[model samples]
Target: MAYSYEPHHFEDFSVGQTFESVGRTVTESDFVLHSAFSGDWTELHTNRHYADEEYFGERVAHGPMTFVLATGFVYRCGFLERTVLAFLGMNYMDIPAPVRTNDTVSLDMEVVGKKELSSREDSGLVTIDTEMTNQENETVFSGDMKFLIKRRD
Candidate 1:
């Protein structure tokens, strides 16, 4: 059966649920814009000559950029649309592979935990495991994210 995502409610999420995202190819403009926006002007992420001389042999995107992309992908999946209260935190973040410019990336997530908030009956906490991969199926990033999810009235 095609899994139907539920109405805005804390009970919608369950352990082991996974979501996949549409692909987005990282470009030079994306790399530059993020570098400028975040003030992360690292040579590896911004300078081709420096990056080419380094171990990875080419310019790579910032890790934070990938993080933003993954989060945006989750939103794009419509999993938490109008249902999220606030971002809690993240843990176990890892960049397993290089995120080079021009590499297409996709995100996937799995729900790991859920708990009702003691302070708020209309919301709950959720933990998710996220992985981002490149066109070659190499894992570029992995991490856990926490969110405060709102329930319907």
Candidate 2:
């Protein structure tokens, strides 16, 4: 089945709401482009030979790269398309495993909290717990994201 791509308002979300995204493989080009764009050509992310001597045993994708990709994956799910007013921030971000080339990744998101804003009647805050997992179902990145969502009322 195809994704819904429907935008959801604040009132449409609940504490137990969840979403899953389609898989996207991490590629060598992703590494190269992200390294160039982020100006983070660290040896661990750019040099295979150097990374081989390190604990991870091979070059790994940058933490920020994985985070960005996770956000993109969630975006593709389309629940926040036009109803999201702003991205407040993230909390307690953690990377539990390395993301290597050819590792297919997907995102799982669940709404953990929702609060109406006293200062703004048009929007409310929604907190989502996000996990980005690789093909092996190992969580490579995880965090809580807060967004200001437009209320239908």
Candidate 3:
């Protein structure tokens, strides 16, 4: 089914609403660039030779990179566009599986909870359960993300 690219406000969200994002292929360039940008040129993510000897048996993308890409995929869905006031925070983030080069990943987001902000009538908080899965349907990352979203009223 075709997904809409329209923004969704706080009042538009309901518990159990889910969104599936477009897939993105992770690449060597992604690792290299992420390492360079984050100043985290760790051998596990950069040195294939070292990584080849490690538990994963090959270079793995940095954990933060996975989260970043996952969020990007969600943004591409266009639901949070201008309606999102701020990213409050995340909770219980987990990287259960390694994300390697050429792995296509997609994000599955479900609205788990919502709370009206007594301090701000113009906005509210929405909590979503996020799981990022690879092409093989293995969960690479999971977390709960909270966002302050604008209210339509």
TM-score of each: 0.92, 0.95, 0.96
Off by over 4 Å in 3: none
lDDT per residue as tens, model 2, 48-115: 99999999999999999988998898788999998998989987799999899999999988999999
lDDT of 1 by residue, 31-85 (tens): 8889889999988887888888998898877878988888887777777888998
Clashes of each: 0, 0, 0
lDDT of 3 by residue, 14-122 (tens): 9999998888899889999999999999999999899999999999999999889877877789999999988888978999999999999989899999999889989
- lDDT, candidate 1, at 118: 81
Clashing pairs in 1: none
* Poorest lDDT segment (10 consecutive residues) of candidate 1: 1-10
Cα shift from native, residue 46, model 1 (Å): 1.3
Candidate closer to the true structure by lDDT (higher is better), 1 or 3? 3
lDDT of 1 at 136: 95
Best by TM-score: 3
